[model samples]
Target: MSILIALKQQTDFTSTEQRIGHYILAHLNQLPTVLIKDLAAKTYTSHSAIIRLAQKLGFHGFRDFQRALTTEIVTQEQQAATVDANFPFSASDSVTTISQKMASLTINAIQTAQQQLDTTQLAPAADLLARANRIFIFSQGDSQLRARSFQNKLVKINRFALIAEEYADEAWNAANLTSKDCALIISYAGTTKIHQQFVAYFYEHKVPVIVLTGNPQSPLIDQATYHLLTVQDEYNFAKIGTFASQAAFEYVLDSLFAVMYAQDFHNHLQDLQQKQQLIQNGPLTTK
Candidate 1:
């Protein structure tokens, strides 16, 4: 679990501890450098109380707690910065400020994804995809589009791929899966109960589950055999909620497709060529 989430799960603690928890959640980026004395002063508590709170959250001491929080903060910020650099923007006063801001936001999100990715986790995930008897992708709402696109890409290489959203009973059908099959669950927040239920079911049945989500500390992450992370700026509480994150998911989907194709270059090329020829010569079109 992430340090921020660990602090949140201890809600039944004392009022001072709860205050510390709220402060840490709100200012995770600033917590690493913050002194225990300053935190206690801000929360109207003693320095020892702050230390106690950290210990209760399973940290060795305030310094250790601060270090973990700082690491997460730095990783997140670095990711955000890397995503921001990829997008093109203009400084001209004539250009619409809204357009520029959106571009910058998307760039930052991609950078965040780049920073949060774990290559070790990715290699195993790719191996699973390469060898799975069947691959099922589960997604809902806006995420379904990406799931379908991924399925299409996998099918091009003649992989037995299915999109869970395409058929309502797909998850139920997938319940019979074994370790030979793999399921990819896609969610931005990773908190959706439906997705969680499917993941839990698959996990109990000894199926391999790969999670692609923005939240690494989510309950679903624990159930996943592999996790792919995407980070997007989502501070705006109103207007087009989850838009940035969905865009980030689209980018990640494209990257995943590229990576999988590259991993099996010869097979992918032969499969694509064969499929293209079959479609061209075997199909009749009115157009």
Candidate 2:
């Protein structure tokens, strides 16, 4: 989970703690220099309570917590900036015009992903998926669909794969995970609480985490054993609507699966074909 979400989940938030939380949330951009005593005084809480709050929020101490929070805030701001730079629309643009612009924006994002592609990251991530004793895939919101798709692709290769939706209780599954297992987390924003919780749990237990996300500087990136960066076009003026970033995620998944299949093409193809045959011929009924 992101620190903000962890704070919401774990902090008791006495009136004073609430004050501190509100202050921090309102001013996350300026957190790096904010001192514990200053925050305590502002919130009318004790320094120790603030320290405890920082720990509860998943930081080793105030400085580290502040650093993470600052990074997250800056990342959000940067995404907003990218969106502004790409999205040049006016109230006058028709749906057709807007759609064309959005397409161009998405194309730009894919080009950026092409430039940022790291062959080094791909091999290790493929290795993790190939060699893991067990693989768990976790994602929420739009990313959940992508996670399920990736899980299905992995199963084609006959690996022991589990989707977070199938294993809904992460706390239980995480207890059984070890260094031999792999955790693949997908997040577009890279700031979901449930995703972060699973990542932190796996990190603590020594399980490898492979993160696929748009923001490389995000806190989620810190927990990842392997990071694959994707780009999203943020140029839509309509904040409520979907944009082109999701296509980037799908492209990344497609590339990874292709690389994995190529690594052991013959055996992988045979295994997938066998699984398909079983599904087609062995099923008893539609029920």
Candidate 3:
């Protein structure tokens, strides 16, 4: 766990310890190079107070605490440098540099999405999916590509999902959905006019709409029966492509798929293994 989370969970600290904790959490960037005396003086506390606070948090002393803080800062800075949601690569970057950066950015995106995912939402979303008579996914562009991949996975698991490849197809599918069906709409922005129209249509049909989006405050949330938040720090108009958003979406979808499959864990695994064996054996020779 990060120091920030640790500090937030701590409630038994003395006033002096609280001050030290607050300072450390707020000044994580400066914690690495800061001396113990410097931090004590800055927080208006003493060395003993600093060491006590560190021990309270399970560290041996201020030195050990600072080491952990420095390590976390380094990891975060490295991820942030490469995972620029808007601008991942620079003009001066070489081909090798770009490849390394993209790999780092993709890894960071998936990790962040996992860390920030709301576990409480998982069961309910999985329940909706597992119980639905049919599933309809609405998305466009890269997000739609992820939706398609998710649909394919659901098919393999024997839970089929419907997705439209064009505007007309999307409208037709939306119009035909019933209350028994579940709708999962993927929108990074969550405020697109077209998506809003679809949401309104789904509402009219009383379809349970589950949204996967990064924007928590988006209008889509008001209409959605359930919403799964994804990572969005990498999305920007100035960015070259949709790298982080798609990764986050896929991670969430994969998690949801896993949860749904877990409902019948043995059966799902058996089905997959059977399919694999079929492929390995190939078709029988004609007589």
C-alpha TM-score for every candidate? 0.65, 0.59, 0.71
Evaluation by TM-score, superior candidate among 1 and 3? 3
Task: Show pairs that collide, candidate 3.
Answer: 85-234
Off by over 4 Å in 3: 1-78, 165-167, 282-287
Q: Whose TM-score is greatest here?
A: 3
Rank ordering of all candidates by TM-score, starting from the highest: 3, 1, 2
Residue 92's C-alpha lDDT in candidate 1? 60
lDDT of 1 by residue, 253-280 (tens): 7777777788989988987777677677
Candidate 2 per-residue C-alpha lDDT over 1-287 given as tens digits, one digit per residue, 9 for 90 to 100: 34554344333566766777887877775577878888887778888878777776657778887887777556546545544433445579899887766666566555555545666787889888888898887776677777777777776677657775555776677677789988888877787787777788778878999999876556787878998876454432345444456667776887788888899999887876776666776663233
Each model's lDDT comes to 0.74, 0.71, 0.81
For candidate 2, the per-residue lDDT at 90 reads 58
Q: Candidate 3 residues 131-161, lDDT tens each?
A: 9999988888789899988998998788888
Instruction: Give the poorly placed runs of model 2, Cα more than 4 Å off.
Output: 1-99, 165-168, 233-238, 272-287
Better of 1 and 2 by lDDT: 1
Report lDDT (Cα) of residue 63, candidate 3.
88
Error of 1 at 225 (Å): 0.8
Model 3 alpha-carbon miss at residue 84, Å: 2.4
